[model samples]
Target: MTSIQVADQTFVAAAPELAADVVGDRASWRRWWPDLRLEVVEDRGAQGVRWKVSGPLTGTMEIWCEAVLDGFVLHYFLHAEPVAAPPAEPRELTRVLADSNKALRVAGKVMSFEVKDRLERGRAVGAPATARSGTA
Candidate 1:
């Protein structure tokens, strides 16, 4: 099984509510990635939780997540067989994967910083900060 592992540290503005929301519905992940479906395969309170995701990717991913009242961290392992051979050259595949990883890392950092900033603003103003920060 070809494997891709990704780790993301996310900060939620409403940590408590967000944690509850995430832990509440693993299936709801479909709403985020329309091409993917996630099902909770295991739930271990405090220690961690794991889920299986399959769809267009045609793979089983085990997402081990650790939750805290403020935010949660996720380690995802994607084990999938390519649906089709790359339309591009093999060298291109490496480049594509590198680009994808870079993009995801950038996105994760932006998202985490945004959420943290929003939480800070919310605390300062006593209201939720849902406004775009222009930076992102």
Candidate 2:
């Protein structure tokens, strides 16, 4: 019944609403976190998206994009437990949970860097921004 918490954030050179669009695109999830399956539990418009997670892990994940002076702050959180139980030993369960949490942290880090790279790379090279406000 214990939940592991994974959290991380990065800055992106895009507006909050634009960052949310990049984060909410389901087609990019697999490319970002291939081992995890995510379904939107709620979309917080310019704020971000909350998701129900399944696959190697089971629980909730949230990605928030906050507007900052320079651009956007992308935050990620994962509160979850391993889908498969470890060996019956209590210590084994603890170890498994720790390992899962570590993996989640790495995944979050990777996703954030990838997102930042994608969002900022174009801007760095003078390419026009592709991200647009979710609302017309």
Candidate 3:
């Protein structure tokens, strides 16, 4: 089996709890990494999560969050092999790598921008904000 590996890192400008809510929440996870069909194999609260990836590439992926001085650092790791036969040409390999890299970048953007916005705005991503105690 041909081996494949990918690593990406991004920082979310929010607390660990907020970052986790955006990244770890199943709904957001699906929205962020729509290309990947992943199931949680391990859930490490305050640390991150591990998932079994399916689809074109079959492998294991993990996303972990670490508290940093400014915010939270997101670490993404993927190690897997193609589900089908290996790419026949150098071009094919390049194409596969490009696609995967694009996906990673998109994920990073979603986490850093979309997720951060939702969490920092005082509401969970996709969850409605609750009424203030006294405000109408």
> Whose lDDT is greatest here?
2
15-129: candidate 1 lDDT, tens digit per residue: 3323333433445444434566656677654334465666554556443445444444544455554454554788888776666455544543553454345445546444542
TM-score of 2: 0.79
| Candidate 2 residue spans exceeding 4 A from truth | 124-136
For candidate 3, the lDDT comes to 0.69
State the lDDT of candidate 2 residue by residue for 1-136, as single tens digits: 4467988888776666666656777887887779888888999977888999899778899988887765778899888776775679999877877877887788888888877887676564544443554632
* Span of ten consecutive residues with least summed lDDT in model 1: 127-136
**CA lDDT for candidate 2:** 0.77
lDDT of candidate 1? 0.48
Candidate 3 per-residue lDDT over residues 1-136, each given as its tens digit: 3266667777655656555545678887777777779989998865788999888778888888887754677787778776767588989887987776666666656655775566457655544432223432
Candidate that would win on TM-score: 2
Look at candidate 2 and give me any clashing residue pairs.
none
List the candidate numbers ranked by lDDT, top first. Answer: 2, 3, 1
